[model samples]
Target: MLEHRPVVIDRTGADIHDEARRIRAHGPVAPVELPGGVRAWSITGHAAARLALSDHRFSKDPRRHWTAYVDGRIGDDFPLIGWVLMDNLTTTHGADHTRLRRLTAKAFTPRRVAAMRPGIERLVAELLDELAAVPPGRPVDLKAAFAHPLPSRVICDLFGIPPEARARMLRGGETNVDTTLTPEESAANVEQWHREMYEFVESRRRTPGDDLTTDLIAAKEDGSQLSDSELVGTLHLLLATGTEPVMNLITNAVAALLTHPEQLALVRSGEVDLREAVEETLRVQAPVAHLPFRFTTEEVVLGGVTIPRGEPVLINFAGIGRDPALHGADADRFDVARKDKEHLSFGHGIYRCIGAPLAWLETEIALTALFDRFPRLTLAVDEGELEPQATFIMNGRLTLPVLTEPAVVGSPSDVTV
Candidate 1:
């Protein structure tokens, strides 16, 4: 086991999975420091994280509950402040949390997500066609060409952003999730994001359309009592959560498959189910590495370590996903056929991700289309050369360059030829 140390989360040019394993080696709860030298706790065990996330003693409302935040130690210009300081469902608790979540949930039901299948399938098909058009010998950054745009496009369509305005909205959303940006750049990006979303909400009010945004607005009109800031915050949350996870999910899944040919063969041969593959990818390489800055109401003993009151608690979902104590010594290995693949990739309890169903559908469709179109897809660069996203929050490749061999004519590429 590695000697427990104060782990810092500046993810630039670092291999996140390896770093996560090192943290896990330190024990379930480890000393960690954030970007601004802010001290915190990192929950690195699966069971421990599940408990901490659901524990009522911990609050997500950084603005009201976080002492560092209240004392100005953490400011809006802080690189990670945008995540913790939001006024959305993620940052609220008790009745307010229930009310906001209920209002948003009403519009984003399982039925509504299911209804998006045909459109999602169509969009995936179009993207696969574009990938096919790329020349065979040359490499294409699949992350840029496909993974990033697909989810944004889906969310924009569902949000009823007119076709014309989708581009600007997507650009803003991209900047908001990017951790590579300097603190100053992130602040500017946040401001730009707020301006765009605020305008979008007002526009939706003026001209409603057959979209989820309209549905949410109508729900508000029907006595939901959603304030303007809350409404915009909800919309921003939807856009950010909707894209970041799905984008990373797709990118990580592809990276996993291309690096593990035997597992990819099982997927291609239908021996291993696609759902199983996606779930395994989620378990092995969680889309979100660590959830930033959940504050404790009081001093809490976690994994035999005492965390002081109002200190930030970062749930290291990535570390937990690979914790051998929970998943056995082979937890780090990617095995699509592995059973008992329980994981906290989508989080646990009330604060769990609301867009999980949509994310699953999008990833499944994207993978299915890409593989069906070109079964011989392989990485253009060495797996080691694939750079991870600079931010510790998201564990995904910056660019996934791949070479897609043409599909076989006589039989499916996995079969003959």
Candidate 2:
């Protein structure tokens, strides 16, 4: 038996990196208490995280495997219930997970993701144009103005959601990912999200277009096994997955580059590839802080600790990235040129993020365009003044206030250059 008092993860202050380091000190698998005193285990070691994620004994279906959830201890009223109870590829396992993933994988193929580069470049250019319009020396909140909207717009276009409907989706999506919401608010937000997604599905069905949503509907009509719940759930997953993580990817990558001028200079000067920069950012500052809600099917020992069956397991991606056992002593340092850059930022095995290719494309394009337009961009406030989102699952700044020198128009039409 470990200490009676578990580390409460909810009170992580301004520096979450330090918090992750502190959790890692408690051993690879440490007991933790989330807000409202929800007891769980946190996998804070790199090797242990990989084992937990890939281990078949650890089921992703919380409804089936989580004893606390089955016994009502992890109720719907729980703040994090909205994430765990999701009925899409995230929560499904076995043949069901394989089937659902197959339906969605067609849309994210390398060829398809590559084909989106032109559109993504156009969107990035447009957003950068808007950013350039901001007055010099005036701090613009990049999260709201650029980082957030770039991916949102791309996702909306992909799903054939109208510009008008995006406002509703954005509003509900914001509320859903916000971990600071009260249980009541969280439930309400999730219901609202469901309603919006249902409407989106219905709208797509009524007016099918040359879009992924319409494609999914067609697949269902042509005897694909996607049910109503899966359809709505997948749409919600796409939006949530697309917007929040990708938004943070862009914002976090920019923040990383801004804070690490030496590394940023390499990317800016073409010495280091932007892809490398993005990879480094993903390793050091993964968009999602915690991979919440994996449940053990049977008692399992990891890193010298026994996790009882049916306990909720959280993979601390934040901690794993900095584990010295994997990355040596300089693991905490941000190095775009690091030789060993393996990380679980997008996860591992069959459940790795299906949208990772698109995300990488989006981030690379957005970063390349933004810097090309404003090569001298810098944070407007002290780095310490920037605040991360209050949520433990999502790791990003609430706002990235940045200033740049006046933009000069001398770019070729091709943003990929």
Candidate 3:
């Protein structure tokens, strides 16, 4: 019999919601294939995704019995297994994962996320001012103008990355995140990206700054901190988590609000809490549509079905957030004040996003300033003209072009050009 050619159920926000419904109605396990002969069972139901992801029965270690299910059908070098072999957080398991987690956990505490606020607010204003300078009614890619810079610059700043190195790191950061490439290509790029980022840690350690990287390096220098691999990988994980999702959330949230002017007006007029609203948007449509890939260490079962062993069992991030069974009647609606933390935007269980507070803080400040700034700002190009990031992992409007003319919504200044 021919190997199963997997079908793609959800490629966009609409499809992701639709697919989550489909999976819930059809039960938990769904099949899909990679470019090679590798087949994966995607867990769409939120509860099932949680269970499958957290269960110890699932063998996360790829080296377990690799000869049978995974042979040379692929290649010696592959991206799927590289994640487990390299870096810090993604590669470790058991005691190792636990140890490193303890050291880094302090940095992500709600207090720490809260502490970053003023700096984040200042950064948000700078980004908006830069965007405001762009002529209105003319096309400006909001991705580059506002959505992009707000988080990219914030993350780079938080990590103590210098301005001169920002462009190179930004380019490599996306390449490091792309999950679509062939195994060899992905592996090569991931390693090179880490090597490129090593300087960020080294530069900070040598001449210490008040940024997160410097702090982390200092921790590592103290007793029982992090290994070099853990230091770099954890830093890399932080960047990956911080940049893509926050930017995606900004663009996606702005797009959603712009489309629903009533919602925009409500947020602008202070009828909604930007924090609760940011959570609602993330739940409704997550930017990182797929959770980073995790492996099962042993044979596991979900929805009363067994995943034999060593299979790529994925937790659908976007699908889980929109599951009707979890969110009740208004699950489909985007209401900023909706308090639904049950949604899995930051994930659930041990591996839940540690930087969630940071992510939430960044989005709240950015989106709040966005609607407030352009009380009159509207889309520059037709919605269809915006690019779609086709990769499953990062779902977002590639370039959201919006118009900003006349006046700053709440400001005394008005511009002619």
| Predictions: Cα RMSD each | 4.1, 4.6, 4.6
Candidate 3, residues 1-417, lDDT tens digits: the string is 232335554333334555555555555566665434556777767788777657665544444433333554445355444454555656566766667777787677787778889998998888888877775445577787777777788888878888998777776557655555667777777677777778777777789887788777767423678877778878777777678888898898888887778776776677876666666777887787765455666676676666666566667777777776687767778776666646777766777777777777788777777777777878766666666675566768767877776534555542221
Candidate 1 minimal-lDDT segment of 10 residues: 408-417
TM-score of predicted structure 1 = 0.92
Estimate TM-scores for all models: 0.92, 0.93, 0.85
- Model 2 lDDT tens row, 1-417: 565356788633356677787777888788888766788888878899988888888888887998978888777778876777578887887777888898988778899889999998888888888888776656788899889998899989988889988989877766666777888888888888888888888888888899998888766423565788898888888888889999998899899899999999998788999999888888889898876778888999998888889988888888888888899999999999898888899989887899998998888788877888888898887888888887788789888988766323553222110
**Cα deviation of 31, candidate 2, in Å:** 0.8
Task: List the global CA lDDT of all models.
Answer: 0.82, 0.82, 0.69
Using TM-score as the measure, name the better of candidate 1 and candidate 2. Answer: 2
Clash pairs for candidate 3? 58-296, 58-297, 58-298, 59-296, 59-297, 59-298, 60-295, 60-296, 60-297, 277-336
Which rank order by TM-score, best down to worst?
A: 2, 1, 3
Q: Which number leads on TM-score?
A: 2
- Candidate 2 weakest ten by summed lDDT: 408-417
Q: Per-residue lDDT tens digits of candidate 1, residues 78-178?
A: 77657774678878877788788888887678898999999999988888888888766557889988998899889988888887887777666566556
